[model samples]
Target: MIENLWLIGIGTGSPLHVTGEGMQALRDAAVILVPTKGAGKDDLAALRHAIVTASGTYAKVIAFEYPVRDPSLPYIERVTAWHDEIALRWQHALKDAIVGGPVALLVWGDPSLYDSTMRIAERLDPLPKIRIVPGITAIQALTAAHAIPLNTLGGPVQITTGRQLRAQGWPSRAETVVVMLDSECSFRTLDPEGLLIWWGAFLGMEEQVLFHGPLAEAADQIEAIRQTARAEHGWIMDTYLLRRT
Candidate 1:
């Protein structure tokens, strides 16, 4: 029988975003593993703590410090190694856990969307049967936070990363593009003319900040706020949407 491993999406930065299904999974799991990205991201681990408290789960909770990639190496190679290391940590931790019963990992956002907990989990030896509990995604949170629809009437949407947008420029055949995991604010590299932007940081959290205006007019302001927020908190996760008028 394949061992049970559950990836529970706790939503991004919001305990309220945790679905009743996800909470029930947490309450039922034999073990819950929370990733610790070190100090600046302690709040992320805290978010999981909040979920546990809210769910009223008494499951064994373990905090593991995730492996950090060497920035000097190529992205693919470095991330590949990082994932391997993380899997090793999980293997060691789970091996001796509460009878190796159903294991739960509290992931940010939906596990299928950009978040990589599932990829690392795939590397575990004697892989566990993977089950996912979906939660709100950053794009969804951003759009709702801004009171805007994801796309214009009948318009296609392109979702991409900052690196791809920076390298390939704007994508064709899409009226709206949503960018995530971009620490650099790559939107400034595009021609801001005829474009509108809605940017948000710490979405669904108390410290959330938002800006919306003509791209050319608000790009700088958004970057400035992003920098200030990052410096203030020592970390930041943000997303933005771009639409051509």
Candidate 2:
């Protein structure tokens, strides 16, 4: 039988942001898996290392290169195949290192949000007992960095992706919408009249950027900064929230 598997949320790569329960989970793990996204994105892996080092709670940390999905395939098919490969990678890594013991993965932000760690964890052959330790998410970090509440008084908020917003336009009944995983400036497709947008990139990091104004006025600036940042870093994960006035 498989041992315990802890999916610990690390919260925006900041060791200070790790919760007490998450720290305990890390201490309990026999092996910790760190995923590398190749060279240009080595910083992503480095951030995890920094967290581990700062915590001073030594575990048998191992790094493995993450499997890249084929972009040419249909989105759903591509994701499914990618998850399968990742699961296989995890199995191989676990078998080679830890035998049967508690393993931990430092997830960026809260795994319960848009992350796929839970789905992939379920695909394990002999599923291990799973435990989730929640952490601050990008949305939370963004709002906190900007010093604004996530929702208006008595107003509901919708969280969605760039593709959905681009294809379907504003949600029928949502007063506030938070968008993530958007490569394109999907907000450009909106009418932009009387809409307010708060955009942030590299949230909680030293190089973080924040901009907010009427959608029409701030849209271009957001696009420019996003493009420049992507070019500089070769990858960027950003999120934004839109509120209609």
Alpha-carbon shift of residue 177 in model 1 (angstroms): 0.2
| Clash count in backbone of candidate 1 | 0
Model 2 Cα shift for residue 164 (angstroms):
0.7
lDDT of 1 by residue, 1-245 (tens): 22898999877788999999999999998788888899788888888898898998878987777888889989999889988999888877665565457888998888999988888888876887899999999999999999999999999999999999999999998899999989889998899999999999999888899999999999889999999999998899899999999
Models 1 onward score TM values of 0.97, 0.97
Off by over 4 Å in 1: none
In each prediction, how many residue pairs overlap at the backbone (N, C-alpha, C within less than 3 A)? Answer: 0, 0
lDDT of 2 by residue, 1-245 (tens): 33678899988756778988888877777788899998678888988888777666668888877999999999999999999999888887766574446888999999999999999999996888899999889999989988989999999899999999999999988999999999899999999998999999888777788899999999999999999998998888899999999
Judging by lDDT against the true structure, name the best candidate.
Answer: 1
Alpha carbon lDDT at 208, candidate 2: 81
Candidate 2 structure lDDT = 0.88
